[model samples]
Target chain A: MDLTADMTNQPFPTQLFGDDAIDTAEEKAKPSSRQTVGDPFVENPRMICRDVYVYYAEKCAINNVSIDVGRNEVLAMIGPSGCGKSTFLRCLNRMNDTVGTCRVEGDIRLDDMNIYDPSVDVVPLRASVGMVFQKPNPFPKSIFDNVAYGPKIHGLVSNKTELAEIVETSLTKAGLWNEVKDRLHEPGTGLSGGQQQRLCIARAIAVSPEVILMDEPCSALDPIATAKVEELIAELREQFSIVIVTHAMQQAARVSQRTAYFHLGDLIEVGPTDRIFTNPRHQLTEDYITGRFG
Target chain B: MQNTPQQSPITLRINAGLKKRYNTEKRFKRMGISAIVIAMTFLVFLFGSIISNGYTAFQQTYIQLDVSFDQTFFTGENLAAANFPGLVKKTLYSMFPDVTSRNDKKLLTQLVSSNAAFRLMGMVTKDPKLIGTTQKIWVLADDDVDMLIKGHYDRNVAESNRRINDKQLAWIDALAANGKITKKFNTQFFTSGDSREPEQAGIWGATRGSIYTLFIALALSFPIGVAAAIYLEEFAPNNGWTDLIEININNLAAVPSIIFGLLGLAIFINFWGMPRSTPLVGGLVLTLVTLPTIIIAGRAALKSVPPSIREAALGIGASKIQMVTHHVLPLAMPGMLTGTIIGMARALGETAPLLMIGMIAFIVDIPGSVTDPATVLPVQIFLWADSPERAFTEKTSAAIIMLLAFLMLMNGLAVYFRNKFERKW
Candidate 1:
């Protein structure tokens, strides 16, 4: 109940949008309306979402939020529960398309191509932009197969030996190869939670995506495993531009170059990680950091 | 405070209410265990009764003899009229050399099976050299002799009230003295076709019918059911139409199987003019009954797969189709098959639906193809059950055993697949 309380203040989506003015009602919840806000853009961005609006059936879940993911940088999106941080992350890879009623509006681009364009095939777009989830979901297969699934599907390797090499390299990048090399044929689900999370990361990386999205990847792990995954994420950012959604502000400060704060589905502040943590910003962002309220 | 809390001002103590709660919890646990035990007892009782009645059927009584097989036996052009019974009667008469009345001869021939002639003919056909041989052979004994040997016949009772009279019992005793009467495996019950004579009836025809019908049901239901489930669960928009479809599928699963029989009668036979009582037609009816079960079970199976797996697949740039086919379908296959097995088992045991589809008839020949007229094992059991002959009861029980075996075999396959493809997420 505690974990779910913040995501949805009201019990139902239908209750949130009782009438046709849901868009206007969602607009009023944004703190930007009351004060001027600083810019969150950069000169060279890898992926950009402009005036994005997401709705679940008739209810607006994320209203008029825009942010840019920088090239080869760790951009951490931190927010309380149900603030649409995870939802916004899924949109980058078009993972929301799996939901029957979830609809996304506005322009979202990866590099020069508009990913939301009708002509775009989500398969290649997803291949170019990878994602790792909070809970580890290893296919019901051997560890080696789990990691090789992406590369095999994309035909990244010309032969089995090359595929094995790609799997080894991906696992090494995810920092899981050493512990799991001898047991690559064992089920991936048999690994420790941290190791399985690393396996998912390895699976994601095997396809050689330019960007990777992680949704609270350590929330289901113990502290020790979380620390290992944190280390892995720090190392992974060097090769792939990473976007992480986390509730742990310290994790945001520790692993990110820049941090963005989301509240009530609004992007309240974005700045250098040190400045966002130390310097004062908007009242909502200040209160959130000081443990006053989510 | 922690150490002295028991003696604090609140004066906490173990009360009657707390003790009662603990007692109730224990009682609940005990009752739950008792419920499971009761259910297990019923299952054990059911299987016990069926096996006790059916096991005797697998091994039939036989009488060993040294009947001379000469060229005169097959004098007729057609072997169906071969005088193997006359020869056996003569051999029995020579063995006793004491009974000579027409009544005694008639009762003495009852010691061996009526199909004893066919048994000899089968041997001669298998080896032509036997036509001139005086080889010892074990021939099938009559069902009454079979019961007498199996200890089911009480010779102490009045001979007039019982199936075998005292004269036939005397012949059986004479044969028993020479170690001629024995219990051999009843291979004919499995190899031969249906017969008016209970002893000659075998389950092969009905077994073939069940196999064809079940395969047809599975082939028709599995793909369509799984596809419909995937569409409803993963693709269909949430609206009145899909909701109605979901409700219809759920209701269909609960609809009486007999209703499907009527539907099959009207659609497949009456309207389409398909042959009645054939496995192909029976299979179609069973498909109609099994589709809803598979669809419901397939949806549950697909639903049991966590959303995280779907997210992981989709997150890695796999298309929606890839996400479902590569991940969701494989994960759900075990459950789908388990459901399909249950549905097929239900179909295998179904008789009411087959009755309307003409599978309740007395089919004599073993069905060679799906279109040939045939009855499933349960229907064969039903027809045998309806016969007035006392000997048909054992054959009915044996057929019931055969039906049960088919059910267990299908379920065993389901369990194997469940364990084989079982995920550890």
Candidate 2:
């Protein structure tokens, strides 16, 4: 492949070039064969990305990625470790600001506003776009405090009674209120593993976020806890747009409405979850789904 | 089986060397247990010796005398005009009545401390009515007399080598036989304040000062240290400023505590001109020395909070400050408190730093304010230990016991806090 041409030519139509196009171009310069696949679930996109590139010092971690996440949909990004799926997820909430060497270029917008705009307040931005982590981590406080924390910070409750009510409703929505209602004063960390993850979900819901970003929220959980979280994610999509990064292909197929495949820091293909699993258009996507290579 | 046995006799055993190595391993295990036992025995022996030698220092003896106030000597004319020391000597000689006799004079002088005169004068000035009335009094005897009563005096030793002579022993024996001088448990040693007289001083002043200083230290250190730690650990951007601050805090932790005392002396004492020898300055010095400890521990505690908890808070739209205050700080409090108590304990035992700021003196009154001159337990012990009087040896040991008790209490508090609030997850 002629790497020099891609690096030097600013106007080169990268879409027209296949993996072997550069090698063939030196001989004939013929237009490379190309096919376009539409993402069916992008009818009402909430976040649209175009040519997103994330760099860490000298190395590029996310290179030339473009995708869209739809409203009230569960969008799952699946890739192997260091494939940049989690990096892309963090970019959604601007959580990557915490990383010292990381830098991002290109356009990422929520609705019509650029999220990376300097005028944006990160506090409200994070509130609008919430995130869950791989492990179940509850505050080392009462179970009620865990759920009430978000509402209190956002000033959603005017009094203790209102806070208590918010805590109850949030826990009920997360489907954990019944089991822990009698023990609201007990430390949240005292709960079982699955219960703790659900408590975390309750905590997230208490803030009334519009979007929730989850970075492998079930990776550390047992099969049963993973199933519970998956079910909750499906239920959660009725109210909020959810972006999830997962290594489990089966989980993506089970819970997501749309699936985006990431490989070698590039967005290979994105489409309806069923279509991506059944008949992927991209050769890389097909190979990955068929277990030929990741 | 017989054929197999015969074949085994001819065959080489490949694992025979391994069996020999296993036997050596068994021998090593036996030696390991013996080493552990020997180490434990030595530790026990050391502990036993410390308790045995230090136990007697907790008790003291006093002489109860029905001292008659000589109306002629302490009249209004004498009180307004008499030399304080001369009046004290005249009153003391009246109690013995043999101070002028050459042989008995030495005995009489050795029975009471020279500083006793000053202490008596102070008492007379406080209540002039006692000048004309005979009142029962409990006075602390001289160090040699105290040593005799406590069995520290070696009567068989040469007169020149001993602090007390045979004549002094005779007077002590007479007083003991007459029931005028008796050994009683020294409750005042724990309740009263420090004095120049070794027999009269107590840990009360220094102990109270330590409490007040630690109170201030914990009050300031816990909140400021935890807040700074939380900001740096959870919210601060990974920039040069934060990095430099982290390094400075670590260096502060390693800096000699005495340097902090010098800083306090310069800034709080000379510059600010706060009261010298006050618990306020001592507390301020201790706070500087303790801040690094609290901050380091607080940072560790904040770091111990799993990143997942922060993410959970962030996910809910909590602000950076909110996330730290609501989640991170609460989880880290147990460890933070443990650090605070440990820092206070270290402050309690610190003598050199407090000494630099003028905490090494007699403060005979309980401090009513932080600005009042005070001496802490360690400094009190140091002062007592440096006294020339032989009785101060026991007083120093008593002061050490008080200091150690305070330290143990602080350590116990640390352990209790850790266990009470430690998160299982």
Candidate 3:
């Protein structure tokens, strides 16, 4: 097979082709300097990822990238498919460890703790850094138990009343308590798609995590549910640091204070959401934000 | 629209094949329907033959005779050793006063089951006040007489070929004339154990043996099979060692059942010195036969649980063990139970393996526990089928019907449990 022909046929940015794919002397002379253009750091950061790389067996899924999650702020990561945004989100709590072939290297810290340290346990790490998936997933259990699962497993509450209180507060915070209060005993899976996603958010909040990672949480929801979840994200930003990966640039602009753009496993740009959307510095970021190419 | 001078070749070819296509479709449907009809016909024929041959075994022949339990012989304290058979003989003689030849008298005595004397002994032993009373009692008739009364034997062939001679038939007809012979529901068939006399035989022993053996097999195999399945599916790494183990497990499911019996004989009997011909040994052998099936089914059940549920649990702070036990296992339980029940049903009908473990013993007494020397239903059916007695032929089919009923009950339970526990999502 002609590897260069296949590479050019792919829709990926030209930087992903490596030095060998540059056939012309002029293109080889001026190599693609794959670099981030805007600031990727933040003040009062709750979590920091530095030089992180992820590989699935022989293939590099996430190239070396660094970014910070500010305290009490929603940080949106927008990228096209296969851009390593979700992979980066999963790396926050080491959820990628569940995939047997996946390998993550470099430093990622939550507060003062190195999450990937040998002495650290994933159970507690995951409890402190909770996640919501692309598709809504609720346990095959009552709505009350679905929210209370994390607190119960983590031994956050000792009594039934305390557990119920935690479940109530979590659901209320997720903006679903009013709708589901009368039917707490019904199965969570029986709820509508938006309600199930909110329930998953409630479950994450019940653990009282320092940061919440959402990987396209509204992708499976309808427009109305998406609006509701975006509103919930805005409300959630007052307490926990939120790192959300989204396919919708409008969603990223609407729900987040800061946005980071990733392309072909590279973080191309990061800045204030308005600045990234209105005045992008990187050409690839501008091209993606303007819909010239994904 | 303009019409072409000649039809397009594709349209012409399609139009030509339309009739043939419809004909093929109709022929296929007819063949499928006929296949099902033929299968149903054979099934109906089989059931008809079994029911016709075995239904008579459910009722038995009885003869009423006047017996005067004389105090001279029956003094209640010595009832156990009394000559009840002699008294029965005397009763027969008084009925046939003209027949004085010893051979004729003996032949007359053959009309009733020898167990009838034991029945009289039991009645007298229970009630001593009947000692000098001439009471009319209905007693069980011999199996040969039962066969004749049920019309299993043709009376027109010849005197030499018939099980009941002309004299016995004449006496039976004479007794019938006086309302002394009748057929009653054979409660003994359900209440008693195996006997040398077919009239006294019952299935209660083999049923209990089957229950005990299956109980042991299920109690041991279900948990072990499920546990092994969980470990191999969830905990074991995807490596060559586990791959080989998986291949071997699948291969073991296809191994002949009698091979498991030989393994049980080698491992549990000769090696472990467990008693042979007991439900315990039989159960252990059956467990070996069913383990692979249960494991395969359990793995399939575990595999069917969507991976999203597992990730959801782990995405929260639940440990791996908690994720599996709290979420995945409950979802997979209905399928696992279905597999276990199917395996148990197969174990219920298994005889060749138990035969290897000596469960084919002719055990006459009802087993009270798993360790007792016992035989299961299929083994009992097999033994009855091997017997030369004509009465045993009906017993074999009856035993088969009982086995089939048990299998249906187990499969029905499987369906009920699946419907009850299965969750949507």
Candidate 4:
């Protein structure tokens, strides 16, 4: 996790690590850049990753990387496509277990519990830590049922009215209630792309997960819908910890408190959103942010 | 080559190649349309022939005779001894008193069906008062007489080649002129059981047997097929053994249906000791034949349900089984039922397999249970088709029509289910 420490200590194979060292005086002028060395470590991280490596067969999708998703904060993972941002985010909820060839190594813990522990039942783990996909995958169900699916499957509610209450609260939290209030019985798929994505957010929230993973949740939506989802994400951070994977650097800059830049399956730098954008310690992160090369 | 036409390839090609391409496209479209027309024409021809040949079987010929059942013949000792055929022959002879020679009398007796005497006997037994009185009763005619009445034999053809000879033909003409022979709607054909006498034969027995066979087939195959399909497509890992099983299922669907018959013959009959010719045995055999097709269709149906739906269900904390049962299975049900109908339709038309299982028997009584000795419609048609009798040809066609009608109904229900469960996403 200490980018500068590892860079200075490690001997060779600089090509795999992205940079040899961060000794430039101009890069050191920025104080927030120092967090990139040790832990970008938060006072209280809801979920912590330490030297995590993900492999699909023989190919390494995520190299030795470490980051933290802090409580009541949005940690946006910004990188080019296939840079292992989504892959890393999926590991938090153990969604990658569904992929037969995917293998994850090292510690990915929710609080004190190592989530990758075999003793952990993924069904309940997923209930507690939910995910929203990149595409607006609203189930082919009614709007109300789509939100109720999680709660019903987990047996969180006693009866229909209770489920209805949960659905209403979840949709309201997602800021989709007013637009869809009159047609809750209608199919979730009938909604516009933005509404459908918000419905998916509502579906995740209905389970009352402690942490929500969004994998480029607005990539499929229009700019207007993107702004709406961004606003929702900002509002949602009050109660639930969030880890968002976005290809749009501006989206990460706008919505995240802390941003981690991934380059070629490696976490190159991590710091506060403003500092990472303005004064990236690693040359790769700086070049990427400045559109020099992705 | 390009340098030679560098003046402009587009202009040079447009004048000739464009028209040629357009003409080729037009010709291809014409060929496609012609292909459809030819296919439709064959379909029409087949249906036309079957319908024309089969519709006449729905009607049967009858002879109205003034039968004097003489109550004296039914007295205590003679009640069991009284010869019904003798009484019927005597009654017909008295009416046609002009027939004097012994051979002529024999020819005259063959005019009415052998079942006619039994029919009269049953009527008299039901109502003894009719024995004391003479009543004009309509009785079944012989297969030859029925064929003659229906014009089954070509009148222009030589008498030696036809089923009805010159003497019998004259007798039929005389009877028709006298208003004694009548062609009426064949209600008995729908009500009675199979008979060696073609005119007396009906499909009721076969229909009941088919119902039992189909019920057993559906009951055994559906749950098993669907479950196997779900397991293979959803839960089973992508392993070599799974691949082998999948390949076997596809191959099983294409296997000759008769091979299933041989399996049933070897296993169900020889090894398992299942009683031969019962619907239970036939249904079990058909289930074997139908399983592969149903499984193939079921797997395809399950596969058609998008992976996103599975992911959506799993994302909601639904267990793997729960995900399949709650979403994937329901979405795939219409397709499954459609597949089942297609499989059943094939089973319905199947004759070779059932024949191997002894469903070609000349069963007389309607089957009361699946285990009872029985014959299905297709096997019944096969049996009738093999009979040398002239009238059975029509009965065979009629049975085919009924079988096809049942299949059409099942397919219609399948379409209804498909439409009902066809989801947009």
Candidate 5:
């Protein structure tokens, strides 16, 4: 009932305060700014975003935001629906270029090179930065064909024997080779939900991409499948950088080396997974982690 | 407490308004069922009429005539020097047994086909060594005799109205009783070619033409349509080149089939100067008409493939073109093939377009090549349907049956392909 009254006659903090009160407030903000400088987690950034914004037509979906993904790290992005975590993940590979009206502004770099550079070809970019969707989207073909698809396209193998070897190695890395090798000719869709996800991973790995992005890859899978995928992600970090967007906070804490908390298109806090969960600096991040609000 | 135990709590479980809504929902479902039943009934009626009227066309009737080779007229020395019409006239006289007057001979000659003599001459010339040998030969009788054998003619009809007199009937009866002339199954209907005489005509030539034309259509349309579809759906960027092609393909599919006929006539016949009425021209015209259908269906099949599959391939570093050729095309093939076959079936039934392109009346010996003149089944049926001969009515019906059978077979093939290779994913 008091909501309308607060909206129309809202008073500014500095307007209501004297000079001494403003001085005290400025001193408090200074200590926090100094505290941010000494944070060890921000030191070695893998992917650094500075003032990134994305817009569709007139609507700003992702407002100015900045964060860093550390080297050899699993950084999980979590937010409520429409919070732009997925949008930010797509920026890593310039996948948003596929959309007609989507406009991305500001700098996003992979190591040192700007990924959004007009000179960059999306084909190779997508190859280096692979993405896994929420659903287990396996090709409607044999498991062998599915795994061989990427390697064959890039001419990674010289002949049939070499392609077969690549498929075997990729499937083995995804922990799916032994289960599916005997029935490689069977259609990929015949596999269970978890197996299909792992097959997708094998397909992704076959091309030997540098980074893997999972966008709620286990959302369509059962709990068992989700757990298997989570294990795969943790193991995957040793070979490639992994960025994941998830709705499950517990999953993020369990799998990620670092966590970035986002709310309303803003990157509120990012730190080691344990610190983000146990000792968040931002009130919004704390509220989300503690289940007080999303 | 005892009094309270006696009266259980009065529960209201069902709402009156909700109950009414449930009843209305039931009524709506019943109405939907009835509507579906009505639609099915209409479809059944159409199918029933087509099958019933068309089924009889598959079987045909023919009057088998056993003519004795006259040694005098077909003498070995004279056969080479004799005109075929003279031998045909002598054979027609043989059919009468005894013609007392010249007027009766003339009337009897009219009853026989003008080309009947040519056919007899052909038989004699095939075996000049047999010119001296007298043997029984089976020849197709004239249309009137064939109608009489098939029970379409009445002997009791008035002489003025009847095409054949009672005397001719007596002669036919005498010949039938003596086993010289009899009605038998017309196997020639499947083996012989077109003739001016309705009784002698068969589906063989047109059937062969259709087969050859369809072969050409399948060879050209399937590969081209599918390739274009794959390029448009997978590799080509969504720019003006692809947009223009897509628009043209869609427009081409809807263009009047007659326009394709005109195109075939002008381009293939006039400019390229291909043989008129050739299966090549017909096939080329049909391919143009069929390409759009196949491409549209192929695109739909390609689009049905989920984007996640493409991402999986891309994630693996598969090039865009490789992803399409290896993964997308195989999945889309069944639907594409089905579309091609359905388009071909539609092409098989097209008469008006073929007519405009000169496939209507060409009397070809055989469809030797794309450059050779040819006639297809529907065109043959159309020719038969337009003839003034009363017997050709049955021949047209018979040809219709053959055309329908071909269409059914194509449709069946489409169903088979769809079932056998359609991927669930």
Candidate 6:
């Protein structure tokens, strides 16, 4: 394909690490021969992804990569731009179905059910695995309705009071109930940027999904908001499994238990966050963590 | 980032060019202002001419006369069939007993409108007690006499060119001397229907027809156009077939309105056998003409809705239809309503398509329903403009004023809906 030809024409970032690192990294890191180090599996996983590949038309956006999201655990995928971390994260909930030319191939299962099966409906699958986007995208509705929209559409509540209770619980879980309690009737878009992102998180959890996919959920917030969201992520890990794609390695180390590092659509390494950050195994992962190359 | 006072060569050159750039900007601003000024001038001139020419049509000339309803005519059961014109003529001749030539008598009778007799019949029928009394009443003056009284015709011009001859003018002057000839508010223009006589014509029938036609067109086109827009914009797959459909809709919007009229003529009038000149067929034809426009506009409105909202709804597990209805539709509704209203405005002012559907027929009765034969406002204006009578020129301009007012009203409603429903995201 034209994409592989283009990728070969561009200089690899690892090549800038000087003679010794380049000699060793190139010998082991041919595009077809690259392999993931450390364990990519978990016991009783919430979601099991095996040999997943994604394509956008003729471009292979996601090369063969495998990872697992354990139940009640936070899994963070950190990579540079154009590394396909977000693409892999989106594959977890089949949000890539919205893209007309996008194609995903592999076995992806939520619990025992294969999510990629043709017979599986995405509506219920999405309800079971909700997502939060990079930018704060709250519905242009009241703050209360933003959280209630999911449960209402999924028919999780039978009465107004029950729906209101769900909204309050979701907001409380997202750590946004206090600041937005007085203005629950106001438009969600009227909130601060960080508050809006939290409202989106609330909206996602309102459906009671077992796993939540967050694509750079705090990337658009300020430092304080980012800290708050990182705190919320840690707190949320006790209930729902999470798969977050972030550019910030510090955020991944701070919030995630297991960290996966992607380089050019290839999963380079997977291990405990402390081991990956302090003592990485793969040469590319070491170069990335040492700030030699992104 | 600090500015240095010691100028470099580049700074010196830039300072030299600054005056030129400022002068160019000043010229551009002046040109823009002048463009606006020119447009405003033309608009003011247009309104000024229409108002000046059409204002006189609202007040009609009347000639007061004493008519003795005669016991012979009153004895008959059909009071509408009485010779009320002869009674008015006898009263005219009694005022001037010496002028007794057949030609002069005919000219004297021409001073009052031919509709004056019917006006007298209507008054007597409504009040039966006035039949035997010689009551003084103001009757409508003829169109020519009305023009003369309203100064529409030059009195110093040659008598051959004048609509009212010297003989008729002399009789009008005599009546004026006796305080019998005066102008009154033209209630006939609003109360009655169309007539061959320019002085008797009214726009109420055509206005009602326009209302009915626009109503049917809006009711049919708005829903279908919006639905088609939603399907094409949201649900349809991105393929060559959808692209072709989008292209066809845009092309249809540019098709000449007359082609739609011809299609209406063949399908609605010939095949369907609907009434030829009724508001229903005209409205259907107008719907065909406006549907493409409404669809294009509605699609644009839907496109203007931010895609982030759609993604947000979908992320929450709402189905495609639910996402569109709950978030995207509300966001796009104001734009869609505005587009529909503007399309209706264009439909209201359209005359070519209606002409092909036989809506240009000389309909004189107010339409009672959508199926009744009628002519819309523009068609009425077209008909009046084609008439050779001098008074119809003013009537045509008056109808144009009414049409402009109606168009303004629809546009105002569009703006109101747009502002009322516009939500910030």
- What residue runs in model 3 are displaced by over 4 Å at the alpha carbon? A1-31, B1-28
- Candidate 6 lDDT, tens digit per residue, A127-200? 99999999999988899989999999889999999999999999999999999898899999999999999999
- Report DockQ per prediction, comma-separated: 0.57, 0.51, 0.63, 0.60, 0.42, 0.63
Q: Best candidate per lDDT, number?
A: 3
B1-425: candidate 1 lDDT, tens digit per residue: 24554574444444425777899999999999999999999999988887887888888888987888767877887765777778788777888888989888888887788888777877876777777778788888888888878887788998678999977887888889999989888898998778888777899999999999999998998888899999998888889999999999999999999999999999999999999999999999999999999999999999998888888787777767788999999999888888888888889889899999889888889999999999889888888899887677778888888888888888888898889887776
Off by over 4 Å in 5: A1-51, A159-161, B1-85, B88-96, B109-128, B216-220, B227-255, B263-275, B362-364
lDDT of 6 by residue, B274-367 (tens): 9999999999999999999889989999999877788888888999999889999889999899778878988998999999999999978888
Which clashing pairs does model 6 show?
A: none
- How large is the i-RMS for each model, in angstroms? 1.3, 1.8, 0.9, 1.1, 2.2, 0.8
Question: Model 6 chain B — which ten-residue stretch has the worst lDDT?
Answer: B1-10
The local lDDT score (0 to 100) that residue B335 gets in candidate 5 is: 75
lDDT of 6: 0.88
Deviation of model 1 at B124, angstroms: 3.6
Error of 5 at B182 (Å): 2.3
Q: Judged by TM-score, which candidate is best?
A: 6
Task: Show model 6 residue runs off by greater than 4 Å.
Answer: A1-33, B1-5, B94-99
Docking class of 2: medium
State the TM-score, rounded to 2 decimals, of chain A in model 5.
Answer: 0.85
Worst 10 residues of 1 chain B by lDDT: B8-17
Separate clash counts for every candidate = 2, 2, 0, 1, 0, 0
Candidate 3, number of clashes: 0
Q: Taking the true A–B contacts (Cα pairs closer than 8 Å), what share appears in each candidate?
A: 0.83, 0.83, 0.76, 0.57, 0.70, 0.74
State residue B312's C-alpha deviation in candidate 1, in Å: 0.6
- Higher lDDT: candidate 2 or 4? 4
- TM-scores, one per candidate: 0.87, 0.82, 0.93, 0.92, 0.84, 0.93
Over B324-354, each residue of candidate 3 has an lDDT whose tens digit, in order, gives 8999999999989988998999999998999
Model 2: residues with Cα > 4 Å off, grouped in runs: A1-36, A160-165, B1-50, B66-106, B109-138, B215-220, B239-245, B361-366
lDDT of each prediction vs. the true structure?
0.84, 0.77, 0.89, 0.86, 0.75, 0.88
Q: What is the lDDT of residue B203 in candidate 1?
A: 96
Residue-wise lDDT of candidate 4 within B263-377, one digit each (tens)? 9999999999999999999999999999998999999999899887877777767899989988999899988998898898888888788888888878999999998999999
